[model samples]
Target: MPVRFVIGREKPGQVSEVAQLISQTLEQERRQRELLEQHYAQYDADDDETGEYATDEEDEDMGPVLPGGDMAIEVFDLPENDDMFSPSDVDTSKLAHKFKELQIKHAVTEAEIQKLKTKLQAAENEKVRWELEKTQLQQNIEENKERMMKLESYWIEAQTLCHTVNEHLKETQSQYQALEKKYNKAKKLIKDFQQKELDFIKRQEAERKKIEDLEKAHLAEVQGLQARIRDLEAEVFRLMKQNGSQVNNNNNIFERQTSFGEVSRGDPVENLDTKQVSCLDGLSQDFNEAVPETERLDSKALKTRAQLSVKNKRQRPSRTRLYDSISSTDGEDSLERKGSLEKEFKQGQEAERERSY
Candidate 1:
C-alpha cells in the first residue's frame, strides 16, 4: 500500500499468501460437489424401479432439515473430504464466475507492483543528484577562505611602507630650514663690508683736494716777491746818475777859490813862485782824474747789475724745471697750467722792455 515498502521482499510475500488462500477455497468446493453427485445417482435408480420421479413441489413441502438429519444436503458448507465430485454436482456457472474474478484481481495486483518499481528507481536518481550539489558547495567555501587570507597580508605591508615615508619627509624639511638661515647670515655680512670700503675711498678723495689748494697759494706768494725785487733795482740806477752830475759842479767851484788867494811878506818871491807852480800842478791832476774815475765806476756798476739780471733770468728756467718734476707727482693738469702761467709772465716782461726802449 505505501511506496515506502521494500518492493523486492514485500511484493513476493503478499502475492504468495493471496494465491494459497484461493487454492484452498477451490479444493474445498470440489470435494463437496462430488459427494452430492453420489447421493443423486442412488435416488434416481430407486425412482425408476417404482415407475415415479420426485417433483420440486414435493421437495419444498419437506422443510427445516437439521445438521445430522437423514435428508440433509451439504451444498454451501461441507466438511473436507478426499473424494472427488461429479461434474454434474458442481455449478458450472458459479465456478466460472469465481475463476474470472480471481484472474481480474491477479492482473490488478501485477500492475500495482510494476508502478511501485518505477517510482523506487526515480527516487534513487534524485538522491544521487543531491549528493553532487553538496560536494560543489563545500569546494567553493574553501577557495573563498584562501583569498581572504592573502588580502589581509597585503594590507599590513602597505601600512608599514606609509609610516617609513612620513619619517623621511620630516627629516628633509628640517634640513631645508637650517640651510635657509645660514644663507641669510652670509648675505648680510657681504653687504656690510661693501659699505665700509666705499666710505674709506670717499675720505681719501677729500684730503687730496685740500693739498692741491695749498700748493696754488704758495706759488702766488713767490710771484709777488719777484715783482718787488725788479722795482728796487730800477730805483738804484736813477740815484747813481744824479750823484755823477753833482761831483762835476763841485770841481769847478774849488778852482775859482784857489785863484783869488794872496802871498805872505816874510816869504821869498822865488819860494812863492815854486809853491804856486806845485799847487797848480796838483789841482790840474785832481780835476783830470776824479771825473773819469766816477764815470768808469758808474759804467762798471751798471755792467755788473745787467750781468746779475741776466744770470737770474737763466736760473729761473732751472727752478721751474724742479717745480715741474714736483708738480708731476700731484697731477698732470696742475703742472701744465703752471707752465702756461710762466710763459704769459715772460711775454709781459718782454713787452714792458720794448716800451722802455
Candidate 2:
C-alpha cells in the first residue's frame, strides 16, 4: 500500500526544536515498522478462512473462492488507496535512496548543533571578563575618593601656616621701622655733640694763648723792677761812702760851725740826735737815714710785684690742669666730658695757691 503523510519540519537554526523533531521522526518510523510486520503476517494466513476481508464479489484467483456459477468480473477499491496493488511489488533500491537522504540531513543538523554549542561557551567567557573589569573599576573609584579627602586636609594645614607667616612678617616689618627711626635720631645727636666738642676745643686754644701772653708780660715787668732796685742800691752805697769820710775828717769842725743849724734838709745828719750820731756810724751818714725811708717804700713795691707774679704762676698750673682734662680719652659718656672746664680751672688754681703758700 502507498501512503502520504504531513509532518511539520523544524528550522535548522533552532537546535533544540530540530532535536525534538528528529526524536518524533524516529518514534514515527518505529511505529511504521510495527504496522508493516502486522500486514505481512496477515498476508500469510490460511486461504480457507474467510476473515473480515471476505466480500460477496471477491475474485476467486485474487481474493477468495465461492461456490460455482460463471464468476462475474468485479473491480473493488481500497478505502484509503485505490492503487495499493497496482504495482503488485515494492522496489527496495528507491527506499534505500530516501533513507540515505534523511541520514545526510540528520548529520548536517548535528554539525550545526555542535557549532552553536561552541558559540555559547565563547559568549559565557566574554561575560565573565566584563564582570571582572567592573569590579576593578569600583575599587579604583574608592581609592580616588580617599586620596581626595587627604589632599583637602593638607590644603587646610598649608593655609593656616601661610596665615601665621604673614602675621610674623607684619610684626617684623614694624620692628624694622622703629629701629630705623631710633638710628636716625642717634645720628643727629652725635652730629650735635661733635659740633659742641669742636667749639669747646677752639675756645680752649684761644684762652691758652691769651694766658701765655699775660705770663710773658708779667715776667718782663718783674725783670724791669729788679733792674731799677739794683740802680737805687748803688746810689745809696755812694751816698754812704761820702758821708763816712766827712764824719772822720771833721771832728773839731762841728765846734766852729753850728751843730745842727748849718745842716741842709737834704743832708740826712740834720735830724739826727746825739745818741743817733754816736751809734758807730761806719756806713755813710746819708745811707743810714736814706735806707729807713727809701728802702721801706721799695720793699712795699717789690712785695706787691711778687704777689702779682705768684698769682700768675697759680693761673699757669690751672691752665695746664685744664689741658689734662681736655685730652682725656676714656670711654666715659658725653655728659662727663660736658663738665665745666672753667670750674676745673678754678679748682686747679686753688690747689696751686695752697701749695705755693
Candidate 3:
C-alpha cells in the first residue's frame, strides 16, 4: 500500500490527495474487520440452538454472510452506512496524528522551495551585474587602445622633429668650426701683414737715413770743389795781371827800338814777354770754362739722388688690397661649404622621410 501510494503521488497535485485517501481506506478496513467478528458470533449461537436439525443438509451447506453484498465484501466498498465510515467519523486521535505528520512534511518541502527560488534570483542578479561590468571594461580597453595609438603617432612626430633639430645642430656646428678655422687663418694672415708692414717701415727708415748720409757727403764734396775753383780763379787772375804788365813793357821797348835803331841788340826781351802774355790768356780762359762744367756736374748728381728718393716713396704698394683679396677668397670658400652642407643635410632628411613612409 505504501508503494502504491508513492506510485500514485508521482503525478502533479497528487501527494496531498493520496495521503488523505490512504488514511480513509485504512479506517474502512478496521471497521469492516469488527463487523465480520460480530456476524460470526451470531452464526455460532444459532447453530447450537437448532438441536432437532443437527444433521440438516441446509445447516451444513450455509455460507458466511457479508455486510451489504458479495460485491461489497470482495471489493472492500463501503456499506449503506457511508456517513459512519467517513474520515470525520474515524477516531480523531490517529487521524490527527497522521494529519500533523503530513503537515510537517509539506511545510519542510515548501520552505526548501522558497530557499531554492531565492538562490536562483540571487544568481540571476549576479549575472546581470557581471555583464554590465564586462561591457564597461570593454569600453575602457578600447579607449586605452585609442590613446595608445595617438601616443604612438605623437612619439613618431617628436622623433622626426628631434632628428631635424639634430641635423640642424650638426650643420651649425660644422659651420661654426669652419668659421673658427677661417678666423684663425685670417688672424694669422693679419699678423703676417703687420710683421711685413713693420719690416717695410724699418726698411724705409733705413733708406731715409742712407739718403740723408748721401746728401751730406754730396754737400761736403760740393763745398770742397767750390773752394778749389775759387783758389784756381784767384791764381789765374794774378797770372793775367803779370802778363799785362810785361806786354806793356815790351810795347814800350819796341817803340824805343823803332825810334832809335842804332840802340843795342838786347831788345829781344820784348818779343819773349809778348809770347808769355798770349800763353797766360789762353790758360785763364780754359780755367773759367772748366769751373762752370764742374759746378754743372755736381748739381746733376744732387738732382739725381733727390729723384731716386721720390721714386722710392711712390713705389710702395698699399696693404689694403692684399687683405681684401684674402678676405674675398675666404668668403667664397665659406659660401660654397655652406651650400654643400645644406644640400647633404636636405638629402639625408628626405631619405629618412622616405624610409619612414
Best by lDDT: 3
RMSD of each: 32.5, 26.9, 34.5
**Descending-TM-score candidate ranking:** 3, 2, 1
Better of 1 and 2 by lDDT: 2
Instruction: Give the CA lDDT, 0 to 100, for residue 352 in model 1.
Output: 34
| Model 3 agreement with the true structure over 1-357: per-residue lDDT tens digits | 121212223567555654666676566546654675576466557646752222334423432431221211232432576574356555554455556645644554455445545643564565567679889999999999999999999999999999999999999999999999999999999999999999999987887677667656655554565466456556545654564565457557656766887556865756545554464456446545533334233344346545764767745533532443354355456446545644653464345334322
Which portions of model 1 miss their true places by more than 4 Å?
Answer: 1-95, 154-357
Error of 2 at 100 (Å): 11
Cα distance off (Å), candidate 2, residue 228: 4.9
Q: Which residue runs of candidate 2 sit more than 4 Å off their true CA positions?
A: 1-137, 213-357
- Candidates' C-alpha lDDT: 0.48, 0.50, 0.57
Clashing pairs in 2: 240-284
Clashing pairs in 3: none
Question: Residue by residue across 1-21, what tens digits does model 1's lDDT show?
Answer: 222322234364365433454
> Which candidate model has the greater TM-score, 2 or 3?
3
Better model by TM-score: candidate 1 vs candidate 2: 2
- Give the clash count for model 1: 1
